[model samples]
Target: MRYFKGVLASERRIRCIEAEIERQQSRLALNGVEGGEQVSRTMEGDAMERGFVKLYDFCDALDTELIGYVEEREAARRTLDCLDDGDMVEVVYLRYFEGLRFPAILKLLNAGGRNMSERKMYSLHEQALCRLWRVIPREHRQRKSVQ
Candidate 1:
């Protein structure tokens, strides 16, 4: 859950950083020529150099964080896919990946015309979490030994 939430938050942060970078890039391009700030005009090349340094640092951090978030999300998705039950997989996927609330997930899952109560959905979610927890990294070692 933490990893999934982090992925969503990281995506938002990444987008904001990218937007800032784009804004800075275009602004820096016309820094001196256009209606740039008085400070920029006074500093000449120094202000522009500082702007480039700030943009470069932001890009580097954004790249590193984005990569880490993507890798974590992929690992969670793969782990979720390992569940034998399709219902469990769907529940977890909708909750974590899609960021749907319980009511929304219940609506989607119960759309097959079956009368699925909220309590039942909650139970299924708990079951899915339990199943997910069972497939830990140490369990992989056990499976290998058994094999």
Candidate 2:
């Protein structure tokens, strides 16, 4: 279950990194525009160089993070695949893969022609997690996260 949660956490981190990259790019764009205020050419060049270097570092970090995220997601997929119960798989998939909250998961399930309550979903989720832990091989259960 922690391993599965780590996948979601990795996704969140990736989004944050991407947002930071965008913010940096916008700052760089703003710096490129000539302003009425006088600024030395050397200072401006140095600032631009620093911005580019920061952007490069962010990109490199993003690439490294993405590779680890992909691996974690793939491992999660395989773990989910090991489950024999359909309902358990769906609940785990919706929670971990789809990143849905319990209420939303219950709503989705009820809408899909299955009658389910929040408590029931919670119970099912716990069972699913336990089953997942049992089904996964001991060596493969080790988590590998970039952060």
Candidate 3:
């Protein structure tokens, strides 16, 4: 689950970065300068390109970040299939990937009769997160290892 969340987050980040790169590229293309002025403009364009390249590289790094989460999410899904129905998986996917809040999740769950407290809902969230963290790749772990 954590792995799945990490993948979703990484994908979202990648999309944002790509959009920024596209915006920058379009801006550079629209500069419309020529000759001597074009040389100076080209330098500025080069700088922007470098910046975009760096961001692209960062997006690539996210693939590494996503590796553990992918593996863990798959493993968890398999384990979960053995033990329970698909509801919890759906809830986790919607909350983490769709960015839905607890009240939203509660509304979605519609677990009737029992009055679910916000605190309890948050506790469930924490539990899911913990499970995710346990399964996330070493590289994707919150703290970086000292060199």
What are the lDDT figures for the candidates, one per model?
Answer: 0.75, 0.82, 0.59
**TM-score of candidate 1 relative to the true fold:** 0.69
Task: Encode model 3's per-residue lDDT on 1-147: one tens digit a residue.
Answer: 344566566667667766765665565456552222433446776875565566567666656656755665465455333323344555676676667877888777666565666676667666666655655556555753699
Superposed by TM-score, candidate 2 places the C-alpha of residue 4 at a distance from the truth, in angstroms, of 0.7
Q: Pick the candidate with the highest lDDT.
A: 2
Put down candidate 1 lDDT per residue, 1-147, tens digits, no spaces: 554565578777888989988887887777653334435445666878688778888899889988887887787788887677787788778887888898999999889887878887788777877676665454232222453
Greater-lDDT candidate between 1 and 3: 1
RMSD of each: 6.9, 6.0, 7.6
Off by over 4 Å in 2: 33-41, 137-147
- RMSD in Å for candidate 1, one decimal? 6.9
Candidate 2, residue 25: lDDT = 87
Q: What is the TM-score of each candidate against the true structure?
A: 0.69, 0.81, 0.45
